[model samples]
Target: MFKRVLIANRGEIAVRIIRACRNLGISPVAVYSEVDAKALHVRLADEAVLLGPPAPGESYLDIERLIDAAKQTGCEAVHPGYGFLAERAAFARAVIEAGLTWVGPPPEVIDLLGDKVRSRIAMEKAGVPVTPGFSTEEPDMETFEREAVKIGFPLLIKAAAGGGGKGMRVVNELKGVREAVEGAMREAQGAFGDSRVFIEKWVQKPRHVEFQIFADTHGNIVHLFERECSIQRRHQKVVEETPSVAVTPELRKQMGDAAVATARASGYVNAGTVEFLLDKDGQFYFLEVNTRIQVEHPVTEEVVGVDLVAEQFRIAAGEKLSWTQEELSQRGHAIEARIYAEDPAGGFLPAAGPLLYLEEPRGPGIRVDSGVVQGVDVPIHYDPIMAKVIAYGPDRETATARMIKALEHYVALGVPTTASFLRDVLASKPFRDGETQTDFIELHFKEWKGETDQDRQIALVAAAILPNGVKTLAQNGGEQQSWRQPTPWETLGSWRIGGNS
Candidate 1:
């Protein structure tokens, strides 16, 4: 086991890795930008190193700086939590070349699977079902146009290098093909520094499901089953649950086997996710491979009763998988809701402000993983995700109900959040009936305005109870004071039960 490991990321994921390291008696080192000097992850780690400016290019994404930080801290391994350089093959190679263990798949595997176009070809060759797409050695407009026509309309122009909806476009008709392709290429260049794009037949109303796979240096591999991540907006998942309502016992085995085969073909090791798109007819097609721990991994952990991060440590240490396929079984239902500091009413745009107050929900079967704390300023330099709230129960219904309650109790003032929207989605008919698909948000909440009388009343009550004097409200024909801030003694009234005020 390594004595120390450096977490080369920030936000909730960094805090998550730190806790895991502490449990295993490994000293965790954290790297922070100037803006994150006081971040929760920095405070939790055994030691902290300052990266440069807050910009990702200067701090989190700088491979040389990250390697240097780990070496300077005497870390034996580097854990690149989910974002930033987590999936960057170059970063992983750099860590290996620096004589430090990388807590992820081999760099060669990452390089093979990171390119969406290349991965598709590999999966097809390995007999794994993949969506129909076109990829050539030298891509040109003439080739793209011919392939687009053959693939039919309602196709997607996706970035060959990156994920997260960037460098992606939906082309619904022939007339828009040229503009869409050009725009996607430009966006892809700016986001991933790669100008490559590919065309694929878009499967309409498909469910996004992924299998959690683990492998070791001894060639042992097993899948932890599937996660239904169909609840999404803007091509990004907001809610994920285990034991997908759509997957049956037989289908689970088939998908799990396919996922394992794909991993083996890529010479993969450590933790990774094999994502697939399941159509209405029950046919599943390989989408892509996330060569790192997924953000929605907690749901899998809650159901399988396994610590994935701990498994990552063991695998990186050259230990064989601790459990066999038959030993792992899904015990209960789990759901995860991502809480982002974004305004749902304003098109879910990221909001930046001080966390005036924060009250995370707490209870049995409820877990809150957060990076921000009260009084911390949420800068506009990075992802807006503030926390993740996960709920587990004996069944899907119970889990869904518990999640709704948890979201209702979660509070973060001075900045709008997606809490209310998440609560509504959990309670919606489609989600309750398990009719989730990639178009869930668009189909149900395309023009959603997160306004309600109950919400207004709560805001009004909160304002009236503040220490400052209450503002006056205009009545039918005149202005009147709805209420006034009360002092401790004033609230006691003229008399008490056994004593005078």
Candidate 2:
């Protein structure tokens, strides 16, 4: 075990790594940017180091600064928790060269699997199903259109060097292929400076599923089942769950075997996720591999009853996997809803303001992983994700009910959140019946407004009793509370909302 470990990240993932380190009796070192001086992760760590400016490039992503911080803090290991430099193979190599343990996969695996094109080639070698695609030779539209025709219509022009829908576009028709390909190429070039674009057959109405795998230097490897992450907006997964309704036990085995094969093909180790796209006919094709612990990993942990981060630690210390595939079992269903400070109705514009009040839900089956707190200033400098609310139950129905209850209990002020919208999603027939797809948010829940008067009766009750009753009620307009602020719900008691603004 490492005497000390440096967390080279920020926000909820930083807090997550700190907790894991503490549980393992390892002193955790937290490195923060100027904007995160008072961050919750920094507050919880055994020691804190100031990296640089508020921008990620100047701080969290600055390899030299993070390495110096780890060395100065006497950390024997560096844990890149998810985002920032977590998936960067160069950072892993730097840590190893600096004589510090990299609590992640080997650099070779990161470099190989992190690149989408190389991963695709490796997956094909491993016998995993892959979509047909053509890698761009240069930032030229002529070459792009010719390849698109070869791959057929309805092709996806994607960034070869990045993910998260940053440099991706879809062309359903031939006329749009030229423009779409050029646009994707420019965007990819600007974002990744690689200019390389790839064309692939775009599957229609596919369910995004991914398996979590862990391996160690001792050559032992195992998977922690799968997560149905099809519920997304703009290609970014917004909602995720364990033991997908789309995957059966037999199907899971097939996907799990392919995931392991993909990992082993790249000589992967530590923790990673092998993503796949399952079509309507139960056929799944390899998508890409995330070379780091994912943001939605908690839902898998909730069901699998094992700590993946701790496993990363053990693996980094030269220990084998603690369990085999047969020993691992998902106990229940788990669902995660990512709450962002963005208006779903207003073009999903990011919300930035002081978080005047934040009251997260808590209970037997609920878990909250948050970044901001009461009185915290949510700026426009970064991703607007406020927190993640997860609910666990013995089955899917129970989990849905618990998630609804938890979302109802959560209350925030100042910046607008999709909490109310999320509540509506849970209550909708499609979501309840598990008819979710990648386009579910836009197809059904995109324009969700909120609940009615009957919905705020308890909010009125909470307003009637909460310590800041008057302020809470006044800010949100309860049944009998004062209406001072011009909130969206201000005139709910007076039957007014400006005819849908």
Candidate 3:
């Protein structure tokens, strides 16, 4: 085991990695930008190094600075926790060349799988089912137009080198193919530094399911079941659950087999997610591989009783997988709701302000993986995700009920969040019936105004309690005297409001 490991990321994932390192008796080092000097992850690590300014290019994305920090901290390994440089192949190579263990798959595998076109070809050769589409190393306007006709209308023009909805366009007809391709390529180049694009047939009303697969240098590999990530907005997952209503026992076995095959075909090691789109007809097609620990991995952990981050450490230390395919089984249903610092009503616009008041739901089944605290400033320089709340139960109904209650109790004032929105989603009839699809939000919540009667009641409670002192003023008509109340600052008087405080 490594004496120390450096977390080359920030926010909740960094804090998560630190905890795992501590559990393994390894000293954890944290790297942060200037704005994150007082962040929770920084406070949790045994040691921390300042990278640079708030800009990601100068800070978290700087491979050289990250490598230097790891070496200077005497860390034997570097763990890129999910975002920033997690999927960047060059960063992994840099760490390996620096004589430090990289807690992920080989750089060559990352590079190969990063290219959507190349990965599709590889999966096809490995006998995994792939979506019908046209892919080429060199594509032009004429070729794209021709391919669009063959692939039919309502196809996706996607970036070859990136996901997360970046550089992606859905075209309904051939007239929009050229413009969409040009737009997708430009956005792809800007986001991923690669202009390559590909075309794929769009499966209507598909459920997004992904399998958790892990491997080791000892040549042992297994899939840890699947996560249902169909509830999404703008191609990003909002709520994720395990034991999908769409996946039966036989279907889970099929998808799990394909997921493991994907890992074996790519020579993939460590933890990764193989995503698939399950059509209404009970068929599944490969989507892409996320070459890192996922944001919703806790759902799988909660059900499978595994610490995935710790397993990553063991794999990097040249240990075999602790469990085999036969030994791994999901004991219960788990659902995870991502809490972001964004306004769901205001078109999900990212919000930043002081976390004046905060409270996390706690119970037998609730788990909150949070990074922000009360009285801290929510910065706008990075992803607006503040935390993730996961709930588990013996069955889906119980899990759903727990999740709804947990969301109802979660409180964060001074900045808008998706808690209420997620609660509404979970309580809706369609969600309860498990009719979720990739376009679930658009189909059901296209007009979500966000402020319900409950919100108004909470506002009234705040107004009543926040008036520390009042003065009366007489009107000309001598009506009951009007009252002027003190401000929030005067009422609170530097007292922090939170579960911890």
Best by lDDT: 3
lDDT of 3 by residue, 234-352 (tens): 68899999989999999998999999999999999999999999999999999999999999999999999999999999999999999999999988899999999999988888898
Model 3 clashing-pair count: 0
lDDT of 2 by residue, 303-422 (tens): 999888888898998887989989999999999998988887676778887676789999988999887666556766677888899999999999999999999888988788888788
In model 2, which runs have C-alpha deviations exceeding 4 angstroms?
A: 450-501
Clash count (model 2, backbone only): 0
The lDDT, on a scale of 0 to 1, for candidate 3 is: 0.89
- The per-residue C-alpha lDDT of model 3 at residue 198 equals 94
- Give the deviation of candidate 2 from the true structure as CA RMSD: 9.2
**Stretches of candidate 1 exceeding 4 Å from the true structure:** 467-501
Q: How much lDDT does each candidate structure score?
A: 0.88, 0.83, 0.89
Root-mean-square deviation of every model:
9.2, 9.2, 7.0
lDDT of 1: 0.88
Show pairs that collide, candidate 3: none
